[model samples]
Target: MRRSVLGLLALLASTALQAATSVRYCDYPVYPPVSWSDGKQPRGLAPTVVRELFGRLGYRVEMVVLGNWQRCLLDAAEGRVDVVLAYTSAQREQTLRFSKVPVLREEVAVFANRQHPLAFNRLEDLARYRGGLLFGESYGPAFDQFVAQHQNIEWVSSSGQNFGKLIRGRIDFVIQERRTGQLFVEHLPGAGDIVALPPALSVDYLRVAVSRRSPLSAHMAEIDAQLQQMADAGELERWLQESEVTYRDMVRQP
Candidate 1:
């Protein structure tokens, strides 16, 4: 009787050890190609890479659209979620730990009406033209301050809306990420005349970040190593290309 009780307790402990650990992740629902939730799971480069990386590290990972971008950040900060794949900002650094290796690079570019392009040689040159920017978007501190002080730029609620306003000549230019702007121009009817100006306004990175309060924060170096291997193997670029096609298909679907 004593032996049977000991064996039963050992079996229960073994069963607990065999259980897989699960990780919850969140991302922006509308930022295509890099990461966007499909109203179900996250789809795009960063999400896919992070999922693969963490899964291989023996964690059961699921990326979901918990809410909007702001909500996702809040959740990651407050420990409601274990992981969030996004860009790093000084404000976010207080509560979130970021991987040393970025999952991808994002190029912020200027899109202008081809019929009335602005001769943009330097930052101050933008002051000569009227422009539109997405509401709540940030282009780093210096650029933001310049926009506030020197430029006559209007704000719109959505990136697509900014492009639409540009079409009607309401704004002379639109500031956007280069690839994302390409997708918008391709998908938005009457945006055919929109062209991304050369020499991107700025280059930023997309990284996989974990909440400081989460246990995964201990695996930061391992995550960075995996991301560097992915970069070396060309997996990240392949995923980016695939995401573009996937997103275009999603846009075309009725």
Candidate 2:
């Protein structure tokens, strides 16, 4: 009888452990100052903010740093990863669920070597020039939709490669995010001529994408609400500012 009682208690404990809430997230390792690991741990602007928000919500979060942008999207699409960083474009909206609160504002723009001027007042203006774009990545509706219509744009495997090609004069222009372009420039070896276009294509809101099959779906709305509240109270900006200061301090030190 004692054995039976002990067995039941053990079973209850196991069940409780199984019932503990967990969220699995995925993101590419390349995007620095946003989601990179920085050799020690996941240290970046997005990771810092996200870690704080989810930690406060009492959710056990685990991050899966994937191979590249494409794999991250696939993991989220296949429901293997419970959540992913960044927003869903119109094409991906059909497959994934997005949080209502935006985490960051993404500005996609055209970049060219400063030595050469690539006229880009609007999307239609790019018809004349050969362009390079990140493989398996989208520039929201306007640019992606435009690419679908115009087959002349070359699709490259990585943003670094695209920028490199632009510097080599292999492509007339490349469209990418301003922040991402800055990071790429900082890391790109032997940077020659590269400058961002004065005009931006579109400023899209970036949000956390949730997997529909994950048990965490039920709580995503709550998380989104908390994020919105933080944004309204200027807490998100404050966190970002603090993160920047921390990054600068760390960079300045040994």
For candidate 2, what is the TM-score? Answer: 0.81
Scored by Cα lDDT, where does model 1 land? 0.79
Candidate 1: misplaced stretches above 4 Å? 1-20, 37-40, 128-136, 147-157, 252-254
User: What would the per-residue lDDT of candidate 2 be over residues 140-200, giving only the tens digit for each residue?
Assistant: 7777778888876887656777888888888889877787676657546656568888898
lDDT of each: 0.79, 0.73
In order of listing, the candidates' clash counts read: 0, 0
**lDDT tens digits, residue span 1-254, model 1:** 99999899867644443354888887665567776656667788877887788776667887656435667788889998989876677777888999888887889898999877789866788988898875546667768788889758887656667888888888888888898888868878898899998877888887888999887786676678778888899988999999999998988998
Which residue pairs show collisions in model 2? Answer: none
* lDDT for residue 135 in candidate 1, whole number 0-100: 50
**RMSD in Å for model 2:** 7.2
Assess the local accuracy of residue 103 in candidate 2 as a C-alpha lDDT between 0 and 100: 80
**Model 1 lDDT, residue 76, Cα:** 88
